[model samples]
Target: MKSTIAFLLTLTATLLSHLPTPSDAFVYPKTPISNTVWKPEQDVTISWHDDKHAPLLSSSPIFDIFLMTGADDKQKKLATIASNVDGGTTTSVKYHVPHVSPPGQIYFLMFQTKDGSGMAWATRFTITDSEGNPGTLRPVIPEGGTINPGGIGAIISSSAKHRKSSAAAAKPAAAFADRTATAAGAHAPVKAANAPAASVGGGNTQEENVVVGGASSHKESSALKASAGGLMAVAAVVVISGLQFLGF
Candidate 1:
């Protein structure tokens, strides 16, 4: 009788295992298959499938959707596509894809219940601009490099160094120009000093007046010497005439 009771309990447990459960509400994403390409600002319908055993509507009524990137382990949330969605009645949600910075090929969607009970992750896909081109990824700095906040460290450093070098090169040129100007100023006074002076009166300077005075003095001395020599000759002639008159 105990064996028969044990067999009956085992049969009941097996039957319960095959029954449907609420935990299988959303098990797989269906619309955004692998390698699907999407464009920014475009309307995208994200859909999912539930297990056959799942109920028509999930127990959780509200849901949230996110645009995610990167690997599963290091997934980065890009944006919130929808919030407070009615997940109980529908298996799909419509979202307008926003413009993502550094757009790449590794993008996916994540759907979760409001209470964080259920979740569904879609396959990885590509997000391109309206021109159908996936944007380039931002550059990554290598090891042991200087880092600047809110910017690319290596690029910023290189640009800063270039500006510094340009400034350094300009300093010597400016200094040389200043020195040239100073030397020119120093020589200006000398040039002014050597310039010919303006005549005071009658177009003759003080030097010309000195030369005229010297010529006048030399002429007066010569005239006086000639007058004395003539007087001496006349006196000699008078002396000779008196001696003849005496007839000695």
Candidate 2:
């Protein structure tokens, strides 16, 4: 009987381990999306709908947002607006567009991590430098403000490294769905139905939060959690059956 119980518990645990983690629901915010044309230097805030995953990273994961150009059935990387971003070290990261970027048609925001895994959102926008009066596009800084010059180089360097590493295969952009939310407690994890497609870069695009302790250890920790849950369930069932058999 003990052996039987043990086998059932093991099986249950194994099954549960395969269940999805919170990271599966993690995504960029859907609300307040912009389709504005801007200049080379601008500020764009990367927003995510899943709040619980805001802080769970192996290290502060760097997000590099880029503009992808499609030609000859191959997608070429254009300008990089944001790089090496920690996302406010909280949930949202404010990124400044680099001066190296030029005026062009923007598809949308496509970002990848250091490991090459990424998500891309399809959008219709433009990047231009003409003044407001006769121009259809918007300046990065409409107020004519300036960004801190110090950090731009570091961001650029990191982006270059990423480019080199993934030079072999650059997947065409995917349809990254926008999930909207305000804060950490706003939306429940499982409630999220849409997530960005994983066709862009690498890793589990559905990958959830630091809760499972980043992407590397996610599988192991999920298995552990499953084992624990299985044990509890089996113990409960056995106790109940035994109590019924006793019949007071």
Candidate 3:
């Protein structure tokens, strides 16, 4: 019985350790808006959060930010700006709109992250002249006439190059959903439920690290509960075995 108890305790510990750990990575927090009338020759700020102790970005991997006009993947490139900005996604990049930029209803933003992950992101907003006049009139601008027609769309990160999003007002895509679309897309961000155990990799993986923060708090709780249940079961079995040994 003592040996069995010892083994069970070890097993519980092992199972607990197998829980998911999120890997170190970067994420976009405040990407450029998809449908706002930005001013020409204005500064647009894009920011992100960096969890991994990644050093400040430097040279080597090139970061590209460009503007496109039109909706969806059919956007036409209006300008391409190549840079080597050295801050991780945590740092905000203030892109200067060209004074000669033409006003349009579809102003799409496509920028590749500087991090080696090669995470590409696309966002959209309306383009208006410096006086806040949209080149093309949208049916409905937000209450103050600045937020553009649609709400923000969903957030997107891809490995593909030249990925772009709809420049149309946010009204159509998520229009039927009642709630306005947000950055990236019209749908809500995906939450991990019933996630599988993470693979072992020197104890450093996104699944493993997620326990420490972010949307995976529930996962951590479930893992702890499972480990507790396993311990309880082991205890029950050990008690029953001891009773049998004593002829109870």
Candidate 4:
């Protein structure tokens, strides 16, 4: 009896192996999660568009939210919400983010079917203030300022101050040029006084040399002419004395 029972169990195991394993029946949606943002400390009501997913997902499919923390796609169960599908009607669902999640921490939201065998989707986001939001849909600063601390108003103020300073720097330099020209003009007389001393000293020295040479030349010429006239008179007197001594 024991041998017969063992033979029957072996036959059943072999037959089951030959048969095909049942495939998973659920279909996953390919709709992307859009309009993602972050809110610090406050309850982050995370939501996404689910209208396109109505056809693939069950009419009342239950959602399982998973946050992929660290490596290996390890799922950290976060929250779950029910999908709204009313005969092809479009709708959305929300999941509240934990307040303890610090700023700039990477997190992923994975929407999966309850059976864990349907088409799964995941989108990444970071917790941050509005100004400091990361990822593709980051917050935009205002026209004149930056995000103040974490809001749009601070951004506007920062931008305004930046523009004001830039405008002041960009003003025309004409006024500065005029002031420089005026200062240069005022110093022109001082420059002339410092320059003329060397020129005047050279001119006076040359004039003194010319005057001394002229006076010395005039005195030497007059002395030479007087000596020549005295020699002629002495010669005439000597000749008259010789004639008288000879009694001729």
Candidate 5:
């Protein structure tokens, strides 16, 4: 009886060890294949498969999806595709791609459980512009570092150029105003000086006329005095001749 009981217990232990556990659960991405290509502002579908042992509705009912780039060691998260998704009922989700800067071919999708228990990554894919041209990814710039002149950098450069052109156009107008103000200031003094000079010239002319008039009056008075003296002498001579004839 004891040996049979020990044998039954050993059989039960062996069966229980082979059963699936929470650690054995896994999610597999399916939609983003190697040849898949997406465009900005396009609505795309992403799908995945979960193992039977996965806690789809129990421990992890919600999932999160993300767009990723680079290798596993240096992977970078580009954007969040979906969040709080029901993993038990649906295996696919739709996402609208935004206008991402620096479009490239080194993109992939990652599906993760809400509890961070299990995750899966899709194959590499491509993202192109409206013209179907493959673009380079923007390089990761460190803090306080300069960005390369492309993608977002190109947009910033264009904006800076526009501001510079506006400032350049304003410079000529400012300089012209300054020159006008200076010309006005210089001419104002000249006008004031000319007015005073004209008044002084008129005063000097009046003084000169007064001096000439006084000299002419003095000469006329002297000539009149000499004429009167001559008249008196002629009258005295005529009287003396009359007296000698009458002998009075």
Candidate 6:
């Protein structure tokens, strides 16, 4: 009984030890995306080549290819490009990765041989640009936000001045009504008419300047986000190859 058990144990260990190692000479093209902005209409291809000198994976030599895509926060396997290959000299596989959102990575896999081997290689490519869509829109800043205090004050003063100037430029009848309304709002004893008019004029000038300042902030923020996303996509491609040899 002891001898029989030892023989079985040796057989199991031999089978485990013969597991295939991912060879280093395998090569795949840098996967290409139809667009980088990642809209629903884009298509991408992921392809790879095997070294001719590498060991034939099995008696029949076959591969099963799979594609998985990442979008909107998660990775899901895409169904349209999954298949098994059995023939000679199959150095490449093509996968069409799907995109439905703004950010995504397309990953490709080839399981070596037809016996359901655990060994496989995978690489991720990124989709960029929306199809014919101009791209991410520039956002507008809300008025009266706290970006610039002095500039904000200047804008408010400028708007007030414009309103007063328009009233002054009008005929005397409109001017008197405007001054009368200002006087009625002043709870304290009314100041000199000229002094009150100057103060009201300055306020209108300030408000106009504030509106212009709001526009600049949005352009700056969106640019920063797009630039960062591009860098991350590049890094993913470079790092993913290292993991490919690990068979994960």
Best TM-score goes to which candidate?
5
TM-score of each: 0.42, 0.33, 0.36, 0.31, 0.43, 0.31
Worst 10 residues of 1 by lDDT: 207-216
Q: Residue 154 of model 2: what lDDT?
A: 11
> In order, how many clashes per candidate?
0, 8, 35, 11, 0, 24
What tens digits encode model 2's per-residue C-alpha lDDT throughout 20-106? 344432235442144555443456554554324533343444455444432111223445544554533534555554422223332
Please write out the lDDT profile of model 4 over residues 147-227, one tens digit for every residue. 111111111122333233222222232211221111111111111212111110100100000000000111122322333
Model 1: residues with Cα > 4 Å off, grouped in runs: 1-25, 52-60, 135-248
Best model per lDDT: 5
Which residue segments of model 4 deviate by more than 4 Å?
Answer: 1-35, 41-55, 79-90, 129-248
How much lDDT does each candidate structure score? 0.40, 0.34, 0.37, 0.28, 0.42, 0.29
**Best to worst by lDDT, what's the order?**
5, 1, 3, 2, 6, 4
lDDT for 137 (candidate 4): 22
Where does model 3 exceed 4 Å of error? 1-31, 50-62, 87-90, 99-102, 113-117, 137-248
Model 3 lDDT per residue over 190-231, tens place:
323332322211101111001111111122223334434554
lDDT digits (tens) for residues 85-118 of candidate 6? 5425444444322332222223223233334332
Find the 10 residues in a row with the least total lDDT in model 3. 203-212
